[model samples]
Target: MAEIALCFAAMALRGFGGVLGHSYDILVVRRQWLSEREFAEVYGIGQLVPGGNIINVAAILGDRWAGLAGATAALAGLTLPSTLIAVALLGLASKLAGEPHVASAERAVVAAAAGIVLASGLRTLRTIREAGRPRLVAARAAIAAFACAIACVPFVGLPIAVIVATPLAFLLERRAAR
Candidate 1:
């Protein structure tokens, strides 16, 4: 119970704009608490549900660890502090909205967040490379990247890209399996 609370509190402390992606990956993959596949499953389910992804993750982990009681504890640990901090920051931002220095600091934070995203991408790529299934890994990476890029364009259907790429990824994996 204490450990679960500590884990969530630590996650809450590190929570910043868009930092959850890197944090989730690190906790699920690097820490060996969950497999990449398990993380993907939980994340996918979270996306399908109503709440925020990180909060959903907390709930899922809590449920896994200690059932309903655990889930409630994890939710409280993960959300309360961050929610309070965010509300305080929002109040401060309203006061500082017209300040040039505040605006500059906000821009700096945005840039830092972008850097973190890039670093997380690189780390994921490194993990794929180290998985010892180079051919399948490379093929999936290429397909996923192409699909993602195509999905970004207006009027291009994201589902189409997934439909086209899934078979290619499967074929590549099958070949690698042999």
Candidate 2:
């Protein structure tokens, strides 16, 4: 239980704008708690759920390990550290909001976060290919490209884009599986 809490707590600290990449590194690569396919499946379910994806994953993983208690520990570990830091950073950001350096730092962080997400995607793609689903790469990439394009459209928004893209992705997957 303590280990689960510590694992998520560590992930929380490294989390910037997103933590999916960090989650993969810690849970899959470093800790070896989950395999690539397991992480991908967990992450997919996490995205489908209503709340934050990583948070959902933490809860699920915790529950899988130690039932309700594990879930509680994981959630606390994943949220508490980051929440406290965010509060402190919020106060600081308010104070430094007008500073040029802060603006530059924000841009840099955004870029880094984007890079992390892209890398995570690539890693997942590789995992899919290696999992004996080699034909999925082109289909998955096309779906990703379509989702990205849809997300960039004015007022289209991520939710709508996801809604639009999901069935298409499912269809493509089904076809590819055949």
Q: Report the number of the highest-TM-score candidate.
A: 2
lDDT of 1 by residue, 1-178 (tens): 7677667777777765654665565577666678888888888887657668778888998899899988988888888877888899899898998999999999998999889867865775665455446666767678768876777667766667767877886787677767
Query: Pairing residues by index, what is the TM-score of model 1?
Result: 0.61
Q: Per-candidate TM vs. native?
A: 0.61, 0.64
Give the poorly placed runs of model 1, Cα more than 4 Å off.
Answer: 1-7, 14-57, 131-138, 154-171
Tens digits of per-residue lDDT, candidate 2, 1-178, equal: 9999999999989887568899999999999999999999988999778788899999899999999999999999999988998899899898998999999999998998889888976776565454335457766777777887778778856778789889998888777667
Clashes of 1: 0
- Which candidate comes out best when scored by lDDT? 2
